[model samples]
Target chain A: MKYCENCRVSVRTGRETCPLCQAPLKGESEHLFPEIKSVYNQFILFFKILLTATISGAIASVAINLMLPESGLWCHYVVLGVICFWILLITAIRRRTSIPRGIVNQVFWICVFSGIWDALTAWHSWSIDFVIPCTCMIAILALGVLGKVLHLPPSDYLGCILADAVFGIVPLIFYLTGVSQFVYLSLSCVAVSIIALVTIFTFHGKQIRSDLARRFHV
Target chain B: MNQIRTKWNKLDNAAKLFPTASTRAETHVFRFSCELTEPIEPERLQAALDETARCFPTFGYVLRRGVFWYYLEESRLHPEVMPEQRPLCARLYRPRAKTLLYAVSYYGCTINLEVYHVLTDGTGAMHFLRTLVMKYLARAYDIPEENLGYETAHTSMADDSFRRYSHRAPIKRTERPNAYQLRGAKLSESRTGLIRGTMSSRALLDAAHEKKVTLTAYLSACIIAAIGEDMPLRARKKPVVLDIPVNLRNYFASDSVRNFFTPIYVSYDFSRRDGTLDDILAVVTETFARELDRDKLAEHFCAFLALEENPIARITPLHLKDIVMRTVYHNTIKGYSATLSNIGIVRMPAAFAPYIRSFHVCNATNKLQACVCSFGDRLSISVTSCFTDTAVQRRLFRRLRELDSDLVIETNLLDDDA
Candidate 1:
């Protein structure tokens, strides 16, 4: 299968040009991952890379903490894990391109998002504790760009952001009040992230249902 | 929502395009009844009507850009006008007849004449009109349908529609296609105008056949000549293009529910230009060759879409779009000395043969419109223009009668004095 760049039409396998527009393919089908596939493909990739990167970061931080007991560099490792997580998410949605194109697209969105986070923290006079959930909140909001390219409606993506803010941050609030151990805080954040992300993906699936029904009279 | 929109996104961008300008302000209904040499069978007649509709599916096409040649939807069956409010929009209203009335009802007048402008020219419609009547006759009369087919034989190639019909001079261009200047060109001082004329679709066709020319080419020459004689200032431009409507259904290999047409810019300039009838026929034939080409029509349709996107009012600046639209409305209304739509001759059943002795053609809500139709032996040419000059109309009829010698023209003038 291939995708028409101008109109975003899908061409069947081995087709020379898009039947509707008659434009030739520019080698989009040869790649392992098409820019637009099932939504599950995107979610799965992010989930896998996110697990890989974040778990390694956590293990490295634990090792550093045991080696230099007074250094307490685990905070830096967690923050670095989140930033890499952000970069990985943006690249998944952008067109399959050369390393430079991928880097450019990824970097542009990352800076824009990071800039908004910096401004919001400065305005609210938020502490380091707030930054973790705030970074997640903004990334959730940025999912709209993906939804539009995929022609999915905004409702579900917006719902995901709301869920992340409520579910991801409320426990942080609970932890800030000195209610739980550090292990529970980390576990709750991971659990909340899973639930919010799952809900967001499902909401988009509903939008797809209605859009498909309208087109086919199904 | 995501499931459906995802698939819809895959349809051609051309499928999503729609018309500008008072889109569907008038309805797009068309009807034709036929009388047979034998008594009509209701079922057979209905079957024939279906075939007639199948041929001219352009009623299914939609307008994009300035052309009428695009349809992208899976289903072309637009929702029928709700019976309740249908009366408010059109003055000519009728109660929904019985279920069997579908045959006749489907063939009633097409309301969306604005889209008609870009489709096959009136002469082309005349061919469709004739075929429709024949289809009905073949089914009702038990005659073979295949034998009633038509051949598009073009002979006289290049001639102006007006000159052979009327001895009018060409108008000179006072300005170029720069800023639209027709906004200030409204007629302030009233001139005496009296329009009286009649045309038989059969007679026009016969006249073109006699001269070996297409009906559109024949009438177009007369129209150009009339402009040359009537408004010499506006006739200076040579090789003028007419916005001849081409029915997309007959031409394009796509669904016919939307707008589908292209303009034929028939050139009026003649190499051996003479006022003789032979000279006129020569020019008309060649001019038609220059204007009518299927590929050019398709390209024109694309250009129209690129120039203007879908014109839904919510997202677009309505006030600005209207202002721009007004310029097009004024210039075409003014630029062309006049538009002549020969809704050529038709044959209807003897039942309807009584109520509709003669039918006329009028498009858009604009009073400046002019259309002529012929049924059987009866022909009527009608002009609906603002009450500016009553005498120009009188001159029009006078010249029309002088050319044909068998012209029977009548009119209903909407002037303030009356």
Candidate 2:
């Protein structure tokens, strides 16, 4: 035990000075608490570089557009595209712990951003016709395959599949509103969603019901 | 295959605030560690943890978010005993994570049990650590198993005692000026700094008896004086308040291993009263006398329950409730400068006493917190702070050293490179 003459208390550590008084101590040392290394996130520098590159690219694009009068105010597309990239990247990173949750969140953001992108580029209706329905269908199928392959308990992936199925049915609204020009993918998306819902309700009825009750309980 | 219905529980009255108010800095996680006479064996410790986890099923539950409040849902995740890797009292409950709310880790001769506040309080955590230690020692030494005197029934151990004892009472609110706040540079990465002082319990008890005050009261006065000495002249206008959490299981007839404690504030102003330990002890004793009454404590907790029971507050969505509760918790915490929690004496079977050295308890806090626990003649006062300064801890230990020169201090902080 090391005794600090200044604080007059014996310390049970390997340090040379007292923790309280910071004065020199006398005698041998004993280790009580283990030394923990500080956690340093290596991705911080990579993220910082990416952030700086994106901001500077956006600024330089805007500056070039300003210098060239015939460029026709196109810098906004670059700015919004950078913002959209970050939104998707952040959502993916935040939900990386749970694959099911990440897939569900990615589906939602991709559909929304794709639609916004299409609208900004003179509304080709491709986002609603192809992106929304195809994305939803793929998400539902991937969730089912991954849930089975990963052997995740129904409680973990059931809610995510149900969410993706619900999103699949959203294309029906686009079909009814006539926002979707081609009807095959939208109808197929709706059919897939209905079939998935039927399968879930037929087999995992009690599990989904209890999950809903728990999430929605007041 | 038939799916079995999982058990779920509502957050006890005191636990409701932790989910929303806890942050990376103050994780609302506390640790109770038992140091043994010999080095810990990993395989034996893991076996013991498995047995203990089976005994206390509530420890296996995971925190899940609901629309109205966060609830504990039974999960199949098993807690594995690993070597201590993270900092003391690291974050345990992530919002949507499916992991258990408690962890068991061992280092050298000590076995540590870190618990999220939402799962249980200090008293409950102590019971768990004791059981784990007892089980490990029994396996290592070939000792026979024995009962540890805690309720073994799963239903009773998981009961929410706050709802059981709450009565309809008129809520009382007393407005006062803000208490003194500790201002300084906090440690980086929101890490907690722990300095524990282990001394003979008999010496401190005799000192308290000579002054005709309880051990908790004497310690509170010592802490208040330590803070008072560091107070600037202008800061003296604000009283140094110590928030002491009283364990309710002592007054109520329940065996719940969940949270069931209420804090009562003891404020002492140096500008108004003579800044001496005697005067501070007298004030603290009087405050304890008035606040520790059975009826008053009941009424205080009932008032707390009243807010939860309000019709409007019950219907509000959880996102809104989280914001409001976070604000309310911040406002409420402003009324106290520090926290002092004494889990009282920890007892074990006589057969297992020879293998144990001492028990220590501490919590992660944004402000200074002192957790006291005693086993046999050895009493440990663990002081945890997020700030970088140690003046208050220095004074407190110096005062404690006056009582017994055999004080032994241990810290998790490394020496500064000067």
Candidate 3:
């Protein structure tokens, strides 16, 4: 091992200077462990470049729109769209540890954003009719399939699916209140949610109750 | 998803602040490492950890946030032993999770036990580490499980001694201006640079005897003098305070494996007196004598408990409480320059001593900290600091080297100049 005359300590690794005093080390040193690399680090440069480009593009578009009087305030849509996209992307990356939870989060956010975008354009009811119900239906199907493919226990995906099912059932209110211009997708989503809930109750009733108790236990 | 109710207990008085104060930069986790004569067997160590985890039920729980406060609930999730990797004493307890609060990992011959401060204090953690080493050695060598003399009953070991000893008295609170803070560039990637020195306990004890003061007091004085040397001229008006955590087990008879200690501040002002080792030692010894009283220490902790009992604090939601407690932690921690905790001597049976080399204890901090514990004749003083500069640590260790020229040191910091 290398020794530092100044710090009077033996350096275990091959670093040329003392860790404390920064004095030059003498003699050979040893390796402690293999170098570590984080998975996210490989894409860091790419992410940085992408972030710079997106930010610059947004700024340039807004600047050009301001410079030209005929362009109108359409750049606001681009800014808000970019912000919402990044928010959803970051959330998905953070929740990537659990696939079921990430799927549920994505389904919820995508439906909400599409609804907001549709409302911003006009009250076309596409958000409630197609986007909301379709997102919920796809989420239910994806969760059911992923549970089997990933070999997840009922405790892992039951709560997430239950949440999505409850959200899916909300559009039935739109149908009953005559807020939805189209009824086929909303009715289909409600049917799928009821079926999913009944299946979970029949198969994993005890697990759901126990999971709730553990989560809410004070 | 079994319907079994998990066992949990309230966070002790000293422990309540740590969970909120903890962040990725400065986690309130400390590590206890034991180097053996040979490399550890992965399978045997895993079996030993499972056996030891069952023995200490409080160590098996995880931290959870409730409506009003944060509590510990039993977790059926078994914490598997892995190789050490992350920066020293990184955050172990993330909120809203059901993982074990303590982790066990091995690197070469070292068996490291890192625990969140909310789970236990140094004394409590020492007991757990001792038991874990005993179990590992017994299994490794096929020795019969013998009474290592460190084992305590789970019921009393998990007792909240601070609550039991709290007395309802009008508390007096003394406020001091913030001490001179250590300013330096932090280490890269938030890593703590750990440098440890192992020397003869008798030699260091004799040096303390020559000073006519206790070992802890002598070391505290040395630390104060070290910081005093580096303080700017304008900053000398504020005292250089050393925060020392006193183990309450020495005064009160409680076998709590949870937190049960209080910190006493020892301030030595260089502006008033000449900054010498003698001057620092005198001030430290006087402060220790004045503050170590049983009733005085009780009142100090009871004052802390008073805040926890306030109706407003009680009614505050955990989210709001986290913010308030975190602010309080930041402001209160600034009151001290550094912390020095001496766990004192670690004694083991003769049968197990031969297999063990030594034991070390150190904590993570944004500032400097020295954790001292001895095994056999070796006094292991591990200095863990977050700063890139080593002026304070150099002075502290060099002063120690003057006492014994045969001091041997080991460290985990990689050089930047390399």
Candidate 4:
């Protein structure tokens, strides 16, 4: 038997919104609490699935290897991983996944690529540095030139790296001069960390401030 | 100058507009002042003036950078030239007389940089003032050129300097709901926004000390509560933010005065209704102490100046520069609701001190501007509204006295002066 004063809508007393007016109900200030209670919640879920799959795959591969040492059982596990990945990828593609979820999926694919690349290179006794950095550079440049926001040009990346390097130059100079290496590196790292922190903060700030403006009726 | 010119292509459009665009182009009238100290000498004044003029960056042509106008090459005595007057339009080598006390207010006083808001901001003007004094002191009193001041290969900027200027420097507590219609009335004229008492510098200090915060913080908190009680709309948040300008000289050491200080905006959400004069001070004092780290300050100083010294923009037409400066002004996040500049305890070297027994800080913009400055415990609360909104200015001082029951305020700016 609750009614909104402005909207004249009947709503449940304890509910957080009016049925007709859709006005936020009183005591619903908790709505301001961020939706994610913990970012670890995401990692935990991902970790659980990753651990289950990796453990099962490794166990199956080890069993097969023990049964037949001559046969490459790791190849079987790799095929199984591909199958599992396709299932998840198809599910993600079919449903409109959150941007963050999509990004995490993309990162997972990159990690998978790195893991397989490392394994293949290790098996062949080949160095990955010469190939990896160059491939990444070319790929990133192409992606950036293609207008992908995530893939920054090599020059732009180098600019940030150089900026970070210059930020550390003073402490680096002090270290190079044999003044306390520990302190200089620690200070230099702090300077490097600030770039990440500010970039992330402003990215969030621009969004948060915009949201605030709408809420505050600015 | 050549270094600046050589780096012209590297400069951005925003930097180009900084000098000329800084003039009160958006508002009604622009007002600013610079104070210089002299080393009690009459003989070396002329040399000091010439030397000071030569070294100061402000001495060169302003370029009317928005438009392609050149006055530096123009004849000083030409019919159109008023070399002594402050430039109404940019793009001129309007040489300011480089004497320690160039007084336009008094005779033998010149209308120099001190009188020109166009040449610099309060921060920029202060640098000129400090350098002018330092140079004069060194030359006249035979102080070393180092006393004239040497630039650090890179000066260590104190964090206080790079602080984002407050948009609405908040100062007050307990605002009421602003349900009443805001008809062309300035907020100051509203009955809800009046000072109830009078407190002198010493008393205000004593009050703040009792509350464990400085004078500014205490006054701001008290005002916040009063304002909160009046502003019904903002009750959703707590620990309302209060932006206070802490003079950089107090926190960091910067010999060059051009914008050496930035105002730190601190928030105090009174959501708990647990607001007190003391709680507000606790947070403010902590922030005031911590925000002025040297590295942060230096970065801000360099970044801000770099923005100002941008050469690419410098080469653009002044009209375009003005347009860009206007946009930049609009985009900025003006830190607080109101800013309080406490130019504490003015010590006017006896000679000049006698002529002015007391002074108050009153700065009004043609647009939405509100700022208060205090010296020797005397507070000046200046609010600017549209020229059409005359009622706002009339009620500002009166309402301020209304909020504080023990405050005794006097103003000559209201009726008689005009």
B325-354, model 1: which lDDT tens digit per residue? Answer: 556555643433344554555555544344
* Candidates, ranked, TM-score: 2, 3, 1, 4
What local distance difference test score does each model get?
A: 0.41, 0.91, 0.84, 0.38
TM-score for each candidate, following the candidate numbering: 0.40, 0.98, 0.87, 0.39
Best by DockQ: 2
Candidate 2: residue pairs that collide: none
Docking class of 1: incorrect
CA RMSD of each candidate after superposition: 23.0, 1.4, 3.7, 23.8
Candidate 2 falls in which docking quality class?
medium
- The backbone clash count of each candidate, in order, is 98, 0, 0, 72
Model 2, span B222-317: residue lDDT tens? 999999997999999999999999999988988999999999999999999999999999999999999998888899999989888888888899
Chain A TM-score of each model, in the order shown?
0.24, 0.98, 0.89, 0.29
- Model 3: pairs clashing at backbone N, Cα or C within 3 Å: none
The whole-model C-alpha lDDT of candidate 4 against the native structure comes to: 0.38
Which ten residues in a row are the worst by lDDT in model 1 chain B? B93-102
Candidate 3 residue-wise lDDT at A113: 94
Worst 10 residues of 4 chain B by lDDT: B1-10
Locate the minimum summed-lDDT window of 10 residues in model 2 chain A: A31-40
**Please, what are the lDDT tens digits per residue for candidate 4 over residues B275-355?**
554665566677666765755444444555555445674455555655777676544423244444554543333323322
- The C-alpha stretches of model 2 lying farther than 4 A from their native spots are B170-174
TM-score of chain B of each: 0.51, 0.98, 0.97, 0.53
